[model samples]
Target: MESDYSSAKEQYAALGVDTDRAIQLLKKIPVSMHCWQGDDVGGFEHAGASLDGGGIQVTGNYPGKARSMEELRSDIEKTLSLTPGSYRLNVHANYADFSSTGFADRDALEPEHFKSWVQWSKENKVPLDFNSTLFSHPKASGLTLSSKDKGIRDFWIEHVKRCRKIGEYMGKEQGSACIHNIWIADGMKDIPVDRQGYREILASSLDDILSVKISKDYLKDSVESKVFGIGTESYVVGSHEFYMGYAVKNQMLLTIDMGHFHPTENVADKLSSVLMFVPEILLHLSRGVRWDSDHVTLFNDDMKAMAEEMVRTGKLDKIHIGTDYFDGSINRIGAWVIGQRATQKSLLRALLEPSEKLMSYENDGNYFARLALLEAEKTLPFGAVWNRYCEECSVPSDLQVIDEIMNYEKSVTALRG
Candidate 1:
């Protein structure tokens, strides 16, 4: 293994790339793993409250979906064990630990409601990010923040405010800014008679929610947009235009999910433009087939392009990376590991990019040579560098990791009754 890496390192050096520096640099970037994946987006807020109203639909009935916070944390621990480098946890408001008492509704939630989550983070040395739960609740059956009904709109606004407070508490406890992300399911299944009206209300509700003064030292707020969702096949209130304008005007982070756009739209192309205006960016890495926007991530052309764009931006600190996919057909823990591994590997390959020569070729209008070099890059010994990185991170450098996941499923998740 050492010999292989040594040869690869020398090869990369010939292209003005430092493999050692790239490895060390990639280790410092934290990837926040989504907690909803562990339980198919099911939360403890209500009994048997599966994913509803949200464009999201978790299809698989894989045994041992986390029934409680304890099981979920245990599963997350298993996931972290397999994935290399730094990581944080992303939790929705619905996933709030209600096990302390009987239950506390979303609007009434406080930091105390998430005591278990905080303790778990401290125990595992993991940081956390928070999301306002805008789906599956009674008020969410139709529209939430954008609902014309004053009562329903106010309810959701209060819920988001509380969610931000929880994010602040989490950030303070973890001593890192907790990314408070806002994504709502307020759209029409068909062409709405009042698209502008709904958007107006949504903007107002967002203003009310963001009016609260949460310090950036603790909470970094972001708004997420989607092109369309299951029920929102026709029009989404928080379309890319809505959130992009809001994020830019408000100087907040804009979350760009890869699967949240037209199939032909490349997320990689948006980064350079979005970064120019927004203060920072939050990335929800996901892959959808045609319309479903929550497929397990893979190291495909789309992912590679996104990673390369991020590295070329020269603003790693301004980016928050997180995986946002759920696959019920496979072991849940294995799903988490697979997505994160792809996320890490994509960035690792980008970090090892020979940008100098590639850029020079382009600047000199040597397009043919540039294309030739890029095609040649695919044949490089990237596997050697990746293997060495995994070995150092104490994870398997080969497919044996799958065997480990299988062993865990048999012993842990499969035994769940």
Candidate 2:
């Protein structure tokens, strides 16, 4: 229903975003967002189990019990109200097991769970986006850091196939309702492995995962269904990010998380001029100081500078703004609202400022202030300019990040067929 690049320039304009530069800087802004607590609430009870390893000391206080599916949806509805763009619900398994009492399990691929999720989405106009388990309840979920190995691969493939079957099943009855979004938490942490091995694992896992939804004939099964492949960049440099380029050729796009980069890891510098490396989704927008920290959006000038740069570079087209916010103790709904609004406002400021300095081939003293003033103005009206910017800016693609995986599978299928 929405065009990929709707009113984006106007969004930038209303917020005093660098319209000229933003227009030239980025291409489209198909919005795909992330909400930590969705249908399943208690799934993350054991958040740091994998990090702590074996002994499984569940330290955090259980704020209360996790929210129910209905409560989670209400959170989503409030999120949608403020977000007002293309969105998909990040589906944690709705069951309660160690694997994540609230997230997915082998049962996620089960007929019942699949049907329930689809029915839920269809009734509420929400789509289920898949997030693989990297960390789960300490003792409950069987997730391990090394899950990128065969077991994890097999688990993902099975789940993917079941998801496809469910979609097909639903199409038979109610047309298409569910589109899958997948982001895997597989990669070596401290283990010893070669760079090549890392690249190989990433490439292979992606190939295996996407192979699920292959239609007898390639090309996505329908307009409503597509796979979005979210590939997180490395926490360290010279690691795996460079290798992700291979995904593009495989027909997979990227989703770079803001916190993944250090201050030195200037996202604008890295992605701005580069034409080949484009991402479908962008996460961790408000996480940490530019130099370090994860899942934090405390707000800083340097971060604002980064936002201005991204908009000026006009890379917003490839961006789907999100926050990787998840704290077990805090009110999940409130956390989501705060994080989402903070990140969205930051981007809106960047989108609205004039891009004169960015577009200027030569550097001048006015560059910082030109962008800084724009940022200030938005914050001045109690961020009303930021609000206006968000309201005005056009959303990017609504294609679930999973669509890329499905598309790739169709390619794989066609090649085989």
Candidate 3:
């Protein structure tokens, strides 16, 4: 394997590509892993809470899903062992650790509710990120934050406020900034009489929520948008335009979820434009089949294009990359490993591109040569470099990862059933 990597490295060097530097750079970029995939988005808010309410849905009935915070952490540890490179755990407010004591409603939540998670992150040496749980609650039936009923709106606003405090606590404890993302499933199923009224209310509600000042060093805030959801097929209150303008005016990070836009819209194209105004942006990397289905990510063209654009623009540090998908049909740990590895592979391939040479060709007006070079870079030995990276990181590479997952299932996950 070393000999093969050496030969591939020399070949890449001929094209002005440094394979070793690419591997090193890839190792430093951490992909935030979502915790919802381990349990099918069923948080511990209540024992039998319906998982079908939110604009989101998790398909299949895979066995061995984590039923407690301990089990979820165990599954995450196993998944992290298989995945190479650094990572952070993205937790939803619903996943609060309230096992020792009784349940606390969303409005009553505090930093104590999530102390165990902070400790677990510290022990694992992985940072924590947060999301306010705006779905699967009673108040979310009609609209939250934008509801005409002021009481319902106040409930969600208080919940989000507490979530921001918790995010600050996690960041302070971990000595790194925790990104607190806000997303809501607040929209009407049918065409409404007053679209402007709902947006105006939502804007006012957001202003109130953001008014609670938390240190920017501890908690970074970002707002996410959606094109359409299951119950929100007609109109979405927080459309892309609304949040884009809000994020720009407020100087907050704008989160772009790949599944939240139209099927034909290229999210990669929006990155350069959005970053031109906002200081930074967050990405929820998910694969949408026809709509926002949240399928497990693959090393497809969309993934490649996004990674290529990030590399080409020379703005890798300005983007926060995170995975956001839940596939309940397969081994949950395996799902995490597969999606993260695919993302890392796409990034590595993008790093291996002869971008500078291609740019030089274009600058000289050699369009045909530039096109040919771009096409030829695809056939390079990317897999060889990827294998070497896994080895350097001391993780199972190639087909060996499958065997490790199977072993884990037989030894640990299978016994859960």
Name the regions of candidate 2 deviating beyond 4 angstroms.
1-31, 38-41, 44-65, 78-87, 93-112, 122-128, 134-153, 160-202, 212-239, 273-275, 279-281, 284-286, 289-299, 302-306, 356-384, 387-417
How big is the positional error of residue 88 in model 3, measured in Å on the Cα after superposition? 0.7
What TM-score, to 2 decimals, does candidate 2 have? Answer: 0.60
> Pairs clashing in candidate 1?
none
Worst 10 residues of 2 by lDDT: 221-230
Evaluate model 2: give its lDDT.
Answer: 0.43
TM-scores vs. true structure, each candidate: 0.98, 0.60, 0.98
- Per-residue alpha-carbon lDDT of candidate 1 for residues 32-62, written as tens digits (9 for 90 to 100): 9999899899888887778766666888898
lDDT of 1 at 291: 88
lDDT of each residue in 17-108, candidate 3, tens digit only: 99999999999998899999999998988875566556877888888888878888999999899888889999999998887767899999
Alpha carbon lDDT of each predicted model: 0.91, 0.43, 0.91
